[model samples]
Target: MAVQSPSLDDPRVLVDTPAAIVDAIPPYAPRSEREAEFYALGDGQMLLNIGPHHPATHGVLRIVLKIEGERIVDLDPVLGYLHRGVEKLAENADYHHSIAYTDPLEYVSSLFNELAPVMAFERLLDLRVPRRAEYLRVLSCELLRVSSHILFMGFMALDMGGLTPILYSFIERDEMVDMLAALTGQRMLFNYMRIGGVNGDLNHEFLSRLGDWMSRAGRQAEAISTLLNENEIFVKRTRGLGAISRGQALNLGLTGPNLRACGVPFDVRRAHPYSVYPELDFDVVTADEGDTYARYLVRVEEIKQSIRIIDQVLHEMPDGPVMARIPRRITPPPGRAWAAIESPRGQYGCYAMSDGTDQPYRFRIHDPSFVNLQALVPILPGCLIADTMAVNASLDPIMGGVDK
Candidate 1:
């Protein structure tokens, strides 16, 4: 038996297909300099500006990518769009006045931002934070960590085109924020942590609400896991993508879950033991595979650990003054001190130098998002152009922190 093929000369098929029209068209000279420049791209690679506005960027993050077709040749992450000159602003303000300015650094996990400066100021002035205050600090910090990671996981999934996870994650996040608001006045940027301790003690309503949220946390966590963790599309998109070795992660100054994802057991709370972290018993979560999926898993595991820490803090909470006894005006002698905390993003630290006056001589912050963001420079090369968003999401550099 023989099979007859359709002929290219068939007018009906030719008109229906693109080939006949393309062949019929005649080539013309470049009409202007713009047309000539556009045609010149045929012989060379192209540079694309993804955004200072695209949705996947998380903030006002612009990534300039040089590519050869679908393969990325180079990527440059542009920052400073959200910069408020926080360090400079803090230097001009009084030691106590500067605490509020730190809130926007990592806006999602604002408690950690507040914690760094408060700890630094406490160390600089040799102020003693009460045991009850320390427990409150740990509880607030851990709750913020859990809340930040939940949003991070949701955004990571959202970048990969999953919407349900963000919706479900927000449900949990609002509950946590609501409880935090009952303690402090604000929900997101709760400038809760003060120099000696927290602004106020956790109220009964906040405690009762926290207990309710903790009880059902596992179910909500499982909902997100079911949506993404083992899904074929999520796995295929992330499993082996943007892998970094342990040494490279260390060399790049990666920290938090991004660093832990590379199998490094370095956590500021565990290693340096700040506040009540030394008293708390919780395992530092790490993943051997340093890929996007591994980063996701590390955050999820850390959320569980944070919940465990919160439970312990609640159970063993001591009764004492939430705020330490201190002078009305804080005028520390000339001294410099640095303090760090394990934020959801990484090692968030603040350095303060007192000049014998009320204001700090110099105030600086070490934002983990800024350090973790550099990981993308090494990880992005050779990845497909589409994978750029996935890699950025895994790095999770909040521009508020990065550009502060």
Candidate 2:
């Protein structure tokens, strides 16, 4: 019997070949460049461009992958497609005016982005926010975190093949957004925090309503947890998927729930203690599995913890001015400083370089989504393609945050 070898020119072979095989073919390129530079050194392997729009790419992300069978040999993540030149725009805007731009940078968690820039500006000007203002900021930030996490939980469940939970999650989120909208006048992109304090005080009626909403939200969260937590399908889909160990997560700069899922008790609220966090009592949630399930569990527990923090801030909130006594045209001395807050996703920081002007000389944002995306390369190789969406959703990255 004669064995037929596969021929590259055979149309049948090309047509019948699997996508993995088709992806192995190298694209034609210029030969003027160094071979070692143009092509990876050593044995030739087919390179495939996964996407700038692939659902699993997270958002507007392009990944160059060298794969052999189901195993990813090498991976390169390409970003910047969503970049809107926010940092550059901030340089041109005056100190107070820049808050508008930061609000859109992390669209999902705009409140935190606003907080980062305004808080940095406040620090630069040595502005003192009133105790009431501090508590308000804490309350709102925690609420924003809870709102963001609820969205994540819903979307993640959707990616995991459960759709009902997302609707339930969004029902809770809509209520929270309505509550925030009542206070800030904007649902998602709220430029509510100013250099010295919040935009306005929470009226007594608003507080009374918020307290009632909080009670209802707490009960809703508990109900949702009971429905999803014990569901066999959810457990099977999430459990033991996309595992990341503590040391690896630390090296990759993973923060927030992604870091906490690895059993590392390093929350900015607890570790650094900013805002009114020092006075508020709340537990830092952690999980040992460092897997998708662990990440989900960490966030679920975090929502509960945020409730505890908000309750304390509301109960003990003091009465005073919300803004500082800084001059109308504020300017700080030439200096640089870093300020980080416990955003819904993780540690969101702003590194501001001022040149003794109202406008910042240079502003750099250390967004957690961008940092957390790094962990994908190490973890993607061993998992199946279906699990790609699972892992990406587990990371819960917002492209605006990553690109900005």
Candidate 3:
């Protein structure tokens, strides 16, 4: 039997040739000239682009990173992929109609986004909301917060290599969103909050389910905490990873769980009271460690706080009109008004300027995802490539809110 030598023309033989392989590959080029500045492929550093469409980014967020081995030496977040010109659209829409446009600013917690614009309109028009309306608003917003946080916890754990928590979180979140849908008619994007007040009142069925959810929320939280809180891998991955000090967090304009995790008791609900938050009894959940683990704990504890607030609202809810006595067409006096609240992510604020017209002269949003996302540039450096997902998950930025 003759043993034939491997042919040089063979695809396998060609791939094995070092010179042929090098010749086959082309030199890398920057996507744009502006992007050229991000390249620092000198010595041991190499340029890495994470995604405009990465699952770990949580949305359509792209991050350019310079890595030395597995450690990120520098990073720049590329934003605006999901921008929809929400502010410009709100400007042209009627004050009453503008509530609909604000819903997508923070797509996950649409109630909070809607709340900002409606609250601004109420202030802009100097409209007095009924006490019952205030109570209902608190109830709806807290429900939305819990729902958002539940899903956020799931995603965070999932990013950190735990799959069970995401499912457990969705279990709670689905029920919460179902209750919200019953009250608001929509699940994810709720345009339920009107200019003066909410579109409709919560019915007995919604309230009953809410009571049941409130009862089981503690047990569910405990179960989740038990599953992930002490897991050695989770603890090692998140503990002391991407730690942000109190000053750094505040300086970066971090809020909500991210800020609280840094030991700053700067809840917009407590520090800057809005709606019926002043009347509600709840403690600001905080932690000394501002790492990924601390952020997780802060959010879980916050779920309990939100439940407590909803309980208070239920007990003290007044019997009055759900909608304020405002005309069909809302035209605020020619002036500017700003309203902000503790959104699930952080401070979700809206600024509206009227020029004595039905449409707003100017409209702007101060989204927490946008602001808290800034903290990433600072926290990302010195963190390992594997830890990037964990750190970004801790921030929990939604591109809808970040880019809006």
Query: Which ranges in model 1 have alpha carbons more than 4 Å from their true place?
Result: 1-43
Q: Which stretches of candidate 2 lie over 4 Å from their true place?
A: 1-51, 54-58
Local accuracy of candidate 1 as per-residue lDDT tens digits, 46-79 = 6677788999998999877767889887766768
**For residues 1-404, what per-residue lDDT tens digits would candidate 2 score against the true structure?**
88989888888876797775555334466354443342462365556666787654557887766666665665666689999988999999898888898988878788899888887887787767888888889988888888888878787878777778778888888888788888888888889998888898887656766878876766666766786788898888779988999999999999999999998999998899878888878899999999998898888898889888888887898888887777778788888878999898899999898999889999888899999988888887766656767888889988888998
Cα lDDT, all candidates: 0.87, 0.82, 0.85
What's the TM for model 3? 0.90
Per-model RMSD to reference: 10.6, 6.2, 5.9
Which candidate wins on TM-score? 3
- The candidate with the higher TM-score, 1 or 2, is 1
Residue 349 lDDT in candidate 3: 89
163 in model 1: Cα distance from truth in Å? 1.1
lDDT (Cα, 0-100) at 397 in candidate 3: 92
Using lDDT, give the best candidate's number: 1
After TM-score superposition, the amount by which residue 46's alpha carbon in candidate 3 deviates from its true location, in angstroms, is: 1.0
